[model samples]
Target chain A: MKFKIASGILSDGLKKVEKVVNWKHNIPILQGVYMECTPDEITLIGSDSDESLRYHIPVDGENVDVVTPGKILLPKQAVELIKKLKGEIVLEREEHILVIKYGKKSQFSFVTSNVEEYPKLPEINFDGPSLILKGTEFSNVIRKTAFAAAENDIRPILMGLNIIANSNELIAVATNSHRLGRVILKKGTDKEKQVVIPAKVLEKHLKIFDLEKDVNVYFGSKNQVVFKNGSLVLYVRMLEGNYPSTERLIPTEFLTEITLNRLELLETLDRIGGLSDDGKTGVVKLQIRSGVAELSTNHSQIGKGIEILELQEISGDNEFSVSFASKYMMDALKSIDDDYICFKYTGNLRPFLVTPSSGSPEIEETQLILPVRERDV
Target chain B: MKFKIASGILSDGLKKVEKVVNWKHNIPILQGVYMECTPDEITLIGSDSDESLRYHIPVDGENVDVVTPGKILLPKQAVELIKKLKGEIVLEREEHILVIKYGKKSQFSFVTSNVEEYPKLPEINFDGPSLILKGTEFSNVIRKTAFAAAENDIRPILMGLNIIANSNELIAVATNSHRLGRVILKKGTDKEKQVVIPAKVLEKHLKIFDLEKDVNVYFGSKNQVVFKNGSLVLYVRMLEGNYPSTERLIPTEFLTEITLNRLELLETLDRIGGLSDDGKTGVVKLQIRSGVAELSTNHSQIGKGIEILELQEISGDNEFSVSFASKYMMDALKSIDDDYICFKYTGNLRPFLVTPSSGSPEIEETQLILPVRERDV
Candidate 1:
């Protein structure tokens, strides 16, 4: 393959696919990005076994000159070197070496891997009907829910996020045993469908999608899921195992409810959480009574902290106290774009629910955290 | 101990001495910062074994309101919590427990560390007369030379930068056996002296010193060297061993001398160096002949890179080649404040020198890198 491209354009393209390029691939060819040039476009493909990314650079203008319509497998280091060059980059295949020239200052000739040795990604024919969502909104939903997915577990379903679509609404849910996050979005009449996509795969694809425009998403049962927008196509394998029913875990009613400024609550939790002894679980006790909420955490090793936050409204007659993970609560609060947050709690041992004060009814968004057993230390 | 101070001011003071606080101290009390409250000023001190810092905040216009003159040690977490709080911070010590209150929003109470258990720094006696240097220039010199000091070695002196002050000039030199950096400054000296200061201590002290003013430095044969200016005093222990004589390592004669733009040469080395094999000994070859200098690096596993840099002038007819650690050269070149750089080479195995073309005697600087022996793979 031969082409001339700007350094900025090349760097941008290489970075988009570099993360998916397996660093420890047993197959040497799998570690390289496949560069193919056609009459109209040049494509760079990088993949492991589970996920793959294909980035296309259109050669419609004279800015990008394509000399030959061939293919070559370029090593990871070659792409990095080309991206780091000072000026316009020129790529040419001379015999077995790919000669990259830039200005009169630098010239690098890197030996390319055999194009035939690299495994070609299968041409997936399942063009499932796509759903369009604002790129920023989709990104925000993924950011809010993906963190609750199990980071490393043998249970494949726990590592994936379930997306359920109905005629009126689309719901996204993710749970990692301790915490669950659910986001809802309103839509017109559409066929109902459900699919589990790996959280990591969706996150990587989101980084490449244009934040200014809408993104198209497609999925085919338990086979594969695809996200395509602009010049990038991201394909991910679907989780085969059934996801746990998360709807039953979140409570719909509460014994006590309180409304507090989101930023103030976040700050108070952060301060009190500093004294927590548990590594991942920062058990902070919250007692809301008489338009005031008291947050406190005591650790045997680091001492204790007490933070008093003013409540906007409290509608509880009797004093109630509950303990939950501080980090989980903070993460849930940060996901919503509302000034005020409403907390619904049952007692000291039951799960507590948190939701944005203002959100669309089509989006049934709520975050749930299981309360820790209250004990005097 | 009781005092009311602005939360922002206390946080700034704590951060000034945070670097000196030992995070992994074997003694628990050493991990805490000692706080002393006087009628006029409040002092915060943090120290490891090698270095100690004392930061003072004067009670001016109610910025600090002292209720009692006492001293206490606050743990890292407690201090950080108090610092992050908003509005005025009140510290009240009742027996062993310290209560910290800020506005009406937060109140944290924690057990204070035993102030008596913390190690006490030696009382600095006026043994040597004070010497002054522009804080900006001293910091610049240290920044340029400290990178060459050995990070980990049995030879303790090699980890320190040698500082020599004569009647006319002050010079700092650092070497890690493989490479060396020397920075010289012209000064109106009153006395001549020589001392070796640990590179780490010099680096830490520079952060607290105001770059716009002059810093007063005092040193003695035993114990610690103190840098005091205004309300800040930084004490750093001097190295016991003798520093290596670096004057003998600089080459006097050269077989080839070339002048080139510093930025172009720096960037060229960075790109070509990417082709070198990974390790501490990543060598990039340089060949200077006629009026052009070519930089290249070839690895058996990766590939090769060649960059041709235009030279303004080239002396000596004989062709010469040398390979040095690219990182070391890059660090040395970054220290020079000049548009052009002059490279001086003696022989294939001799140490080479790099100097700025501006030829400012007021700021004399030199970089030395030893050549690696050529080998056939």
Candidate 2:
């Protein structure tokens, strides 16, 4: 667009939307940042068909000045070039070409794509059943479960995270069938809504949002949702199929309950996990006894590792043992940021739950892992 | 094998030799580190057939105590486990199973490979024509040229760096036909020898060596070269081939010479190089005029970038132009550690030279780039 903006401002706006740009779009024009320049503001939009991010840059910024108002689509290269250059970045359209100039030392020109060829970004609705949560709370719930989401699933619905907002709590759950992570947080809202979004969509926006600020989320119709905070807006398309009942999947009863320092357990799991069999099958045994829990992995090809971690408390059964994929356990253990974490399970094959404690109402978070079943081996 | 060694010391020793362990070895035993523990010292050796590194961990080091003498071959897992654990690590063999214990909290058992299965390290002779140089000097020369070594080569000999010890200089040269780097350091040795060593071997050893200390280089027989200093020893196989005479390839007479700040030119090259047609075809033109050198990359698909840099001096034709792979020029320019570098060329089609100057003769370094022929494009 024919506009002069601060390099930093443009770089930040471009970065937010760049992640949503469909690099593999059938029409190459869709793989560009669509910019609309008006007398008061400039809007940058990027979309990957399923999701989009639209960021607005006001003209009142300290170093930005609008020379003219126009619309154009700039490729990733133009954004990258501006990010590296210093001082004011001036963009002027010459026919179909966009000329980018910085200081007096350098100038870059890109053949601008036809803005009309780009797909329209998903519509954003400001009024809807919404949820309001601190960015950190929202991010934490997503972070705990996103990793458990199926990466490339045969059942595509499993690739999305099931998000439910009801009453004062917002719960997000993700699973790849083998393991599940459910994070429940207080959103301070009474609105109720349920939607499943691609884990990747949440992951991308998580990278940019300032976790300390409040993020407003709105459900747009049944197929779309929008997350907005300050000048940044994210649009995500809801999955069509049904997500499995995650609550029933996480077992309700336990024969044993053990509490240990989260960091201590994480470190121990990491060491034992180091000797995983060929990286693919990282099954390790957790022998919980009085005072200590022994984490061990015995692989015939690689080696064997036994890590003894001191337990904070133990109850229910005096001694118990279970086997699980070490990587899955480590992921669950690492996600918990608490002084002590508790583990509850009923049988060796049942999915165990890992949480901060059995009685913490301030914040609710739980991770469930299905043990590496002996039958599967 | 049978010793109580500090975790830090053992980890450091394992790290140095780990690079030599062949990750892609067909026989898993060959990838193991052969360790021999004596009453006084523990020797750790790793070999990938062509190259090897042997590091000695003395028992007298802090937190180390030898209870007995033994030998065992430890796999990557065992070493990695010990590297992560803290406190004193005790390695004691229980028959064929080697128990690696750290403090009383953790223990990892690796089924030791038969000592006879691991390949022996190359023989290192002390009484040979040798040269000594500060590790920094040795590393600097390698750093400047290693990147030019053919990564995947039809001419396998080009994958190695031709090192010549003649009269009073130790010169190292590497080229992949497209570009060349020659580093000539005044080693002040009279011994004459020439060997082409696989650049990858030097690169691995360079990663572990302390650049500030002195490194000993020994030319063993006609097929092997050994590098050793303090507790570290590296063995590299020497290639046998007729290396092209590098001295003749560098032109003494030139039609144009331009001098500019090395950093300034490098930065400008980087910016102009960013706009390459595609990552694969990075041709850029250097237009050297009276007072300024204009670096530009004009690609029909990716667009064009022009960077104007001030020139300190220019001679011959008032303006001359030449094109080369922008990445090659940037790599060569970045390697020169000089405030100002001089460029000398004869014609657009001829190879050009980039060096600090004609006067700084203490350690002469030159980089050459062959212009991309217009006919080839």
- Candidate with best lDDT: 2
| Candidate 2 structure quality by residue, lDDT tens digits, A195-221 | 999997798679788777778898776
Q: What is the lDDT of residue B100 in candidate 2?
A: 87
DockQ of each: 0.60, 0.66
Clashing residue pairs in candidate 1, if any? Answer: A184-A363
Off by over 4 Å in 2: A127-129, A188-191, A279-281, A358-360, A374-377, B127-129, B279-281, B374-377
TM-score of chain A of each: 0.93, 0.93
Q: Please state the CAPRI-style docking class of candidate 1.
A: medium
Q: Report how far off residue B186 is in candidate 1 (Å).
A: 2.6
Docking quality tier of model 2: medium
Candidate 1 residue A352 C-alpha distance from true site, Å: 1.2
